[model samples]
Target: MRHVLTALCLVLLTSAPPASAQDFPSIGSQYVDFGASMAAVGQMNNVMGAAVRNRRSDRVDSPRAAATTRYRPSPTVSARVRTQFADFIARADPAHSEGLRKFVQQNDLLGAWEQHVAGDGLRRGDVADAMTAYWVQNWQIANKVAFASRAQVQSVRAQVAGALAGSPGFARLGDAARQELAETFMLNFIAQGSAFSDAAARRDAGATRRLSDAAAARFRKDMNLDLRALRLTEAGLIG
Candidate 1:
């Protein structure tokens, strides 16, 4: 399963960009590439020694030590992930897509159609029209697929946790170490799954917000670490 996920990530990262201009224009192309790269990096970290290191470091005794040990994605990667999220939502929901188009048109978000044409040979109106069409075409399919994919990920996590608990190797570990190991594995699992699941959640604004809130809550429940603090440490963002 891990190898499958690793291969999936690799494919996503190296796959050619969508050839159809109608599917993804200049800015959208940038976003998909960035998001895929971020996902690949996450997959690599989870597959390599990072997960092991996190497990070993989970034995910290002091609050400060725990605080310093939380994993954080790079700031630039986080920004790109967020942008991809917005783009995904815009493409998957008709109402959201229309709202975005209206907002862009009202605010002149891309400057002018002529300016976009001059810069990238893409007209602002075309981008808006494309988003609308994409949303209409994908709304139902995207939502259904996203829901199923998220459920499958959760099921896999449960299976992994159960297997680990019953393993002889896990039984040999000291109580503290066993707990740490389980937590580390679960955290890594969530982190890896987030790369794909969160992208799926972007099919709906409510789902996206819920995913964010759930992540913050999970960090607190699983690690006794504040998600906001971790974000601050990673991105230097206040509040």
Candidate 2:
């Protein structure tokens, strides 16, 4: 009953007219929106890491400690990531990038990431909940492109992986590390998207709950070691 109510609420919220249609456009036609969003996410993750490092440096300024910072992307990579963010903002919401970047810089994304990483099995629930919320919020666009072909899905995955590989401090890692993190993110994202589409198409709240749970569990079990190895958090994974 709770699941049914939750699904009904999601439907009601998503069915309403969007505040601005220009924000979505036809970007989903070729998964352009998703690619751009992934780029933005990667950029933001790097920004978050930099912000955290700066704050820590203010309190404890040891050259050796600073030298060991794990997640600061190079300035060149950061610039490239910003361009990708610009592309996304240009297509989705022209006025969004600056404000979003500012918010991320000031936000406690590092703390959020830390909390998520320390949650053990509870971390999966975070991804599952976030995936559900994301799909529900973008139901109009996501539903339209829900049945993407295998080739299309793979293309999008590759683009997103490439984008992430260059940001979020992944640029400092080896090729193998980049590939593993990218694969982990894509697996969870693709599975969540498919599961939501299936549940929505069938109008099955139970299925939605079950599939989301399963996807979350799989993501947690499969990516746990890789995420730790890469020093990435659930916040980064969800992004």
Candidate 3:
């Protein structure tokens, strides 16, 4: 439970050298052109068709405010979508933490999923080593979707995490079969977690829950497959 998202962020910030903020917004080039164009117009109309005195030509855009993204994501994004909820996971006992560590290495789970699946040191599959990459990519997509709104992501993920944290030692069977099944369940949860929060995204969310009932039937099949895979493959106790 390493909080990989925060770790990733700190890595990004610390990896690159810091730059001064003022170096940007290199003076308003757009507004200056507009104001200059208006001045060139000889006609200054008034209520009586008379030339009216004008204020300072410096009625330009704010010098301080700079351009932001066209579609800015929320600043609390990390809390929402980042898989690195490792801090909460790490809060367990040392024995549990050690178990979680084995789980992390076996599944190759990023620090975030480590937080999501607070296991008791279960390792990933001994077989199917290559396909493990699929789980990682799947995890990335799930995190990206959750990043849409952290509160929502946290809401659902918190439920599952609380389940695992509250009821530990669920992974009694430490075998390749269980490892594979656990991976399937974990990735499916990440996907469904985002779908739960994204009303629009639920249309294709595989699991048709309350928030995303648009194509519940279609996603229902997917959810079934995912759960079935987990239960059959990993021995999950999901009813």
Candidate 4:
């Protein structure tokens, strides 16, 4: 599936001149930023979990010490976030990397963590505050980038529609569903994927499970159709 999308992007690139600076953060930008933000959330969760465990241990000297204890981020977790971000950038537009770095810097993520979050261990309350700030800032960034690339997404959607015109999966969609899909396919893709990330950050296992089940459901109540067939079609299991 990634190959197909990348192939489409490559074709688009060859068929036209480079997108203007106004299109700086294209769909690729939203994806890379979202991926990096998700990686940060996962790593911060590890840091917070460790801090919670430490707070419960008998290592503190006194009540005062325990109350003042802060969460020292694990070096391993920090490095892992950087590695994952590097991987994300490898698949993103080169121009988007600069903007991503600036966003991370503004939010004190990655290399800027010590500067904005805390040079020393962050207090338990401070950690929570940092996490909330990170999530909120990243959400704003994702929305801005997604909205900015609307024209590009619509162009790509048209190309995809033309390419899959005779495909059985598309044929199965009702007129309303097809219209909705054409208008908001990429946006829905980002929204649904972001919901899973939000679930993980909130540690809502039940929510994650529900999302997974819905994605795989053979029938959709709202769509009022055999969505399983559409899923198979999207996965290239059918025309």
Q: Score candidate 3 by TM-score against the native.
A: 0.22
Best by TM-score: 4
Clashing residue pairs, candidate 2?
none
- The positional error of residue 129 in candidate 1, measured at the CA in angstroms, is 45
Residues 1-239 of candidate 4 have per-residue lDDT tens digits of 11111222222223232432122223332322333233333343333223322332223222211121123444454444444444444345466556544432233222222222232122122233333223222222222211212232222222222333323443454433332222122222333343444454456666655654544331132212332332111111111
Candidate 1 residue lDDT tens string, 155-218: 3222223333334443354433332332222222222233333334235455444444544544
Flag regions of model 3 displaced more than 4 Å: 1-110, 117-174, 198-239
On the 0 to 100 scale, the lDDT of residue 230 in model 4 is 25
Weakest lDDT window of 10 consecutive positions for candidate 2 = 226-235
Q: Rate the local accuracy (lDDT) of all candidates.
A: 0.29, 0.31, 0.25, 0.31
Candidate 1 clashes between residue pairs 3 or more apart in a chain or in different chains: none
Q: Which 10-residue window of candidate 1 scores lowest in summed lDDT?
A: 230-239
Model 4 TM-score, all chains together: 0.26
Poorest lDDT segment (10 consecutive residues) of candidate 4: 230-239
